[model samples]
Target chain A: MSDEKKLAIIATKGTLDWGYPPFILASTAAALGYETQVFFTFYGLQLVRKKLDLKVSPLGNPGMPMPMGMDKWFPVLGTALPGMESVMSSMMKKKMRDKGVASLQELRDLCFEAEVKMIACQMTVDLFDFNPADFVDGLEFGGAATFFEFAGESDICLFI
Target chain B: MAAFDQELDATGLNCPLPILRAKKTLSGMEAGQVLRIVATDPGSVKDFEAFSKQTGNELLESGEEAGKFVFLLKKA
Candidate 1:
């Protein structure tokens, strides 16, 4: 085995909030000189699409803090109103911008530039009726075996 | 302050942007060349330390100036 450290991550969530961790960690690992690979499966495939449109929903997510002092007094019913998901998503995006957090697209570009391998699960693509052309270029398509080829030998493995 | 071959201003970027940009800068630099970075993110202090250790780069100088964190890193 090569002496270089390797990191493998499985991404399964497509929500805007859940999207950050995999890209952030993988890009950082690659910057650290680790051989990194991120396997996008299930809902995670949404992240690799060329037209990224991930959204966050406050519904059933009690931990999500509402703005305007709503965190302490807001009822769960507030999350069920029409267009609540878009509102929450916009608020989250604004918060990230205010904090100078990198955008998802920027992070993905960094990962690509760093040569971090990105694999899209082929089974999911078929199941979800997604075309390979829909995703960003340079993304590899594979299944469980393909992921294990790299992940099995990796020094660190994470399912995010 | 130590002499540096290049300087990067990362004042408003947060989390991994500063580090990612540093890595990109270091890649284009010759070995042993120093890169001076100025960042405003408080978390970057610890992040740079870890980055130096993990990437085998040298942290020549680490300190604060006028509410910003300054770091000098020597490419390995």
Candidate 2:
């Protein structure tokens, strides 16, 4: 509308697999010279947590394919396993590293360097008992009103 | 004259970086300039092609050389 493209990325998932979509899209939008904002809410707040790397494992997810077995026959064992998410996250990270994709930390740093705005949803932070210190520096804390204000002028709005 | 000459070595950089760098460099140049980008990432080939099409830039020459990709772009 203002001859400048705007993009808003809503991050709602905290899993490792779910973490990539928002960062990737936001980074790409910023690289394209668009006004890009990434709003972290709900479990997605874990992505911005300084201590949590947000890893996921492929095993135990009913949605994930088992190595050589049919997923449907694998039983409910998929969701019952502990630490599968982290394992999957590590595996995915390894795969990306092998293929030369930038690490999540690198991507975050690059996004900041490129001037992508990052916002943390206050409601989720309160619900999760997370403090501002838990997140990376330069993250703004706001509510739905703030998100709507930012998203009102966006040409692209995505929830990932 | 040979249009213009620019070189970009984006080897080992993945998608978006190469495209981002190229876009940044191209934005600073005048039209009709030629930019040569060298990259090793396979995804960059398609990424640059799409970038060229989307940005209205021209892909004058694109080929592979000894495991490296070479792209010649003309700013439009």
Candidate 3:
């Protein structure tokens, strides 16, 4: 085998908060000259969609801090309010922008430019009845065995 | 004010972006050419060091000026 390192990641979440780690790590790995592949399974397949509609939900996320001193006094009840998720999602997006953290689309674009392999799980697509045309161009569709072929030889394998 | 063949301004970008930019820029440069980069992300200080070690690029200088992190990298 070649001496170049390999990185394999299985992306299993679709939430905006959870969507970042896989792309960030994969892009950085590609930047470092590692052969990188990301397998998007289940809800994670949303990341490869042509139009991204990711959102973060504050409900049941105790670690998420509420704005305006609400975290200390408001408890989890406030999260139950209608449209709370959209509110939290917008706030998180603003924070990321202010901190200069790359948006999910930007990170994905970097990965694409760096030639990182992005594979979407075919099983999940069939289960969800998703149209293959809904995803971005240059994506590969495969099953678990296909991912295992690369992951088995990877120096670093992550499930995120 | 170090002499460099190229310069990359990664200001207002955070983790991974600055490094990614540097990597892309360096790939197109000739070997032995020097690249100077300025970034606002505080985390780049450590990230660049690790990047240099991993990629075999030489990190000639790493310092901060006016709160922005500066780096000089010599392509390997």
DockQ of 3: 0.91
Q: For model 1 chain B, where is the 10-residue window of minimal lDDT?
A: B1-10
- Candidate 2 chain B weakest ten by summed lDDT: B1-10
- Tell me model 3's lDDT, rounded to 2 decimals: 0.94
Alpha carbon deviation, residue B52, candidate 1 (Å): 0.9
Single out the weakest 10-residue window by summed lDDT for candidate 2 chain A: A65-74
lDDT of 3 by residue, B26-70 (tens): 999999999999999889999999999999999999999998899
TM-score of 3: 0.97
Chain A TM-score for each of the predictions:
0.97, 0.86, 0.97
Q: Candidate 3 chain B: minimum summed lDDT over ten consecutive residues — where?
A: B61-70
lDDT of 3 at B26: 99
B-chain TM-score, every candidate? 0.98, 0.91, 0.97
Q: Which of candidates 1 and 2 is the stronger one according to DockQ?
A: 1
For residue B7, what is the lDDT in candidate 1?
96
Per-residue lDDT tens digits for candidate 2, residues B21-73, read 78778878889999989899888888888878766799988889889999989
